[model samples]
Target: MTMTRRYVQDLQDGETIEEVFLLVDKQLRANRNADLYLLATMRDKTGIINGLMWNVSEESMAQISAGDHVQIKGKVQLYQGSLQVIVTRITKVASDNLDPEDFQPTSSQNVSELLEQLKSRLLGIDDPQLRSLMECFLIDEDLMDSFSRAPAGVKAHHAYQGGLLEHVVRLMEMAWRIGDLYPEVDTNLLLAGVFLHDLGKVREMAFEGAFTYTDEGQLIGHLVIGVEMINEKVAEVEKLTNEPFPVETALRLKHLVLSHHGQYDYGSPKLPMTPEAIALHHLDNFDAKVHEFARSIEDDPNTDSHWTPFSPRLDRKLFKGAN
Candidate 1:
């Protein structure tokens, strides 16, 4: 493959650049002289850089739109220590030319391997009834296909295809490690909690193109949707076995998954009360925040360090050190 030119961070002052980027946002504007300006967010796998189309022809405005993949020739200039592109020339590329895989961020690990590892862990769960339910979801062909392509969050950690699997696998790993740390906690319960906690996300968030909430998502939300799935699946298991899992035990497991987010504001309608529930809440949030930080690191690799713009997830700036 031919090497594409670098963006502003990769260029020195007075050096020019060319690149392919996803146009995530776009708008036209007026200058003091009422001249036209195009404002947009351009993103590649490495990071996003704000761009401007200053004094461009009216004909150019007719061609560009947000979410269109485009190729641009531009000059790199530093503005207040952040990189900005002053786009001079542009070409709209076929969507296939800018592969979603090339631009969307994903887990920096093999997804299939992670899924296998997750399966192996599930196999080790000792609780027979919980094991059955876990097995059903893990092996459900359709569900596995969706898990393999869905993003865990729209813009946070594991936000690409197969993101849901990656996030769940990571959380399960943590839960298992916690089991090793505290043998008093029932490992089966912990494992079951980890797998089922986010199951509803498959239905809650539509993965048709980009990750966005479905009508169900806006109506029921992931928490409510999730608990309901667990209930439905649990009922399936009961039908197969001709009996129910212990009410108290099943309730505790459901409670952990339901309350893993830890607050109503965070989407957890209930608070985590059991030790397993408490552990899950922290681990899930911990993985998400750490993954997001890792994404921030991937941005502006040439810089020794700089304060990132306010992160909507954290509502603060992050700084990086020399790799």
Candidate 2:
């Protein structure tokens, strides 16, 4: 029998649902009585919902993995003011029957339009050497495709298809305005830094179905990988010009990528030491933190309250005022 599918956003409380969902996360837990249960996060393009499988057997738990599309039978209910599914049955759907497009979320903005905005901003750089460096990245069709599709992170911020492009374009726009206010900042270097800061994420994440860190991402992280990418591109620029790229200019650009995180503990090996690096760090942080807070408010399931539940990341509740 073919069951009617309900997207996560459309599910209502007290409804019995039989649908196919992407298994975004799954884990085994013990109940108070020492019985094992399955805890999972089921998702579709619209959103994700928590799920619980009571009295789950080891054999049943072994049948599925995160990122698999599965047929699920469940009842939707409210738990702690949040929607959760009490799953009764789950079976993995065969790969041939699955269409991954239904599971990946995408940005509201147009991808091509966003890419064009980024290109136009990069082209405005007056420094010939810096513009050449930027050109090397934009000219690569493969890298641009990856950039357009890559997510800014697995979950923290801009974690959707085309999210990387959205985040970068927003950051560039903000950096441009801030550079005007502070003329001391090197606009070319600052803009270039904003463009390159998260470029490594294209390789660091696997976004074909679900967002997850690649093996290299876990081992080395994006900052170091990005620095390596800059070096390779700088070498190419030098070969094309038949002369070495300026040492100070290359060092400054690399510093922005390496130090955008702001502190040693925050993941930066070196702290922001230049005007452009400092501006890049703050601008990047402002964009990411604002998005995180806004997303938290939107994702909050408590429709009856003015405040969202405490976010462990933000360490406080957010006010969702009608005003």
Candidate 3:
């Protein structure tokens, strides 16, 4: 049967939809009445919508899993100010029947062009040891490919394909301008810190199907993994140069990665200690928060409201006004 697919962004309350979406997440839960229901997050390239399949049989629940592409028949409704799908029927679609592009959300920027800009900016660093350390990562074809494609996060910010590259490049641009404002800030070190701050996210997220955490990501977290990556690369750079990478330089760089989250509760093992580390934290936060705010404004489905609903992450409703 030919089905008219509606993208999540275009879905409206009270509309019946027959669409193919990637089942990005699924869980079976018993409600207060002890009846099992399938709770799922369905996605297409445009966005995600939560789905509830009531009166789901055990066999039906067993047949579907996260990462599967399924054809779903559902009705859209507004739940708690968010759009949700009340799924009535679902069937797994074979891989050959689906187009991969319809499932993944990607950054609007050109991936290759953003990557070149990143490399060109990194090449501007004149500190020999730091440059050599950066080279260790840049030259690895496998790592670069993953780095180019990985998301900055699973959900926090820049959570789309090629988002890591986009986030890093944006941070670097901010760092370059901010670094010049304070003579106390070391431009080369600050830029290096910005470039390497989220390096571990390339490993932390699995993007082959949906953006989800790897076992390593859940267990070790990106900060520690990033520090480990830095140490491994530092060792290689020292071996290649036949000279020890400067101890203080390596320590400072590692510090930046470890403390980029800025606080202990936020997941940083250590708070930002060095000047560069502190600046990296602020710049990273600024970029991520601004993106979240802008995205909230753009993605809000309410056409009549002039203000976005309160964002738990931001703790305030954003006014959509030109003033």
Candidate 4:
């Protein structure tokens, strides 16, 4: 039976809650007086929250693991401008009793509909070689399935399921506008770059249970992985078309993947050198930054405040507008 439960995002300070949450991570820590406490990061579709249980025993830690769906009884409170729960009790919920859907955050966008739009946009590219290259990836059902399910990032912009697809589609929309404005820009190549730049994220991210990096993801990352993925598809395009893929075209596409991050400190292997590459870099940043700011305001638990807490990652507090 389906059940409605209070989600983490709806939690308010001073309110007591008893709800089940996905246990994303947990640590046993010692206080100054040597008392043990359990620090846990919990989630449920809406957002993630931290909970602290004071004077916990070793046996209590044995009751729950990082991926378990556990029932928590706690009081929500604001600490240092952020909200957290002071957990009084926690216990593992029987897996058979609750649906996992209640705990995973999915995209607000429809997956199948967005995918069709994505295919139509890519398939519409007039450049035969580029279209064939995109078809190579699109024809791979397994990869497309992963792409549709993967989050764009673990914590930043579009962190939920299907976020990668959403991010790419939004970029495609922007690419169309930008291409129209700059007639010199190759729209086909720009579209291909947009699709391929983050294709490696399907492999880079492991989203089956918890959103996190795969072992290969931590080692190589999406940029290098993306270049490799494009080469593999490029080979398929050549074999299928019975023609050699253009060397310069392939190199330029790879540049878009490697240089999309835009800077040395941001992990781009090469800086944007081409018109397409520079356009992609700025477009990607513009989308990601705007999403981060919007998400910050939406997820801010401080309803009474006009500004969100200073984000160390973003390095600035977002204005929430006059309340």
Lowest summed lDDT window (length 10), candidate 2 = 1-10
Candidate 2 clashes: the total is 0
Off by over 4 Å in 3: 1-4
lDDT of 2 at 27: 90
State how far residue 83 of model 2 sits from its true place (Å).
2.4
lDDT of 1 by residue, 35-144 (tens): 98988777665556778878876687788776677788777776755578888877778886456766665566898898898899998888787788887777688887
- The residue pairs found clashing in candidate 1 are 149-162
- Total backbone clashes of candidate 4, pairs 3 or more residues apart or in separate chains: 0
Query: Distance (Å) between predicted and true CA of 184, model 1?
Result: 3.9
Off by over 4 Å in 4: 1-4, 30-36, 57-59
Tens digits of per-residue lDDT, candidate 4, 1-323, equal 11557888777889988888888888999999999999999988899999999999898789899888888898999997788999999998787877778778999999999999899999999988888899899999999999999999988999999999999999999999877789888888889999989989999989887787889899999999999998898888899999999999999999999999999999998999999999999999999999999999999988888999999989989999886
- How does residue 52 of candidate 3 score in lDDT? 94
TM for candidate 1 is: 0.77
**Candidate 3: RMSD over Cα atoms?**
1.4
The C-alpha stretches of model 1 lying farther than 4 A from their native spots are 1-18, 25-42, 50-67, 72-92, 96-100, 206-209, 306-323
Query: Per-residue lDDT for 211 in model 1?
Result: 51
User: How far out, in Å, is residue 306 in model 2?
Assistant: 1.0
Flag clash pairs in model 2: none
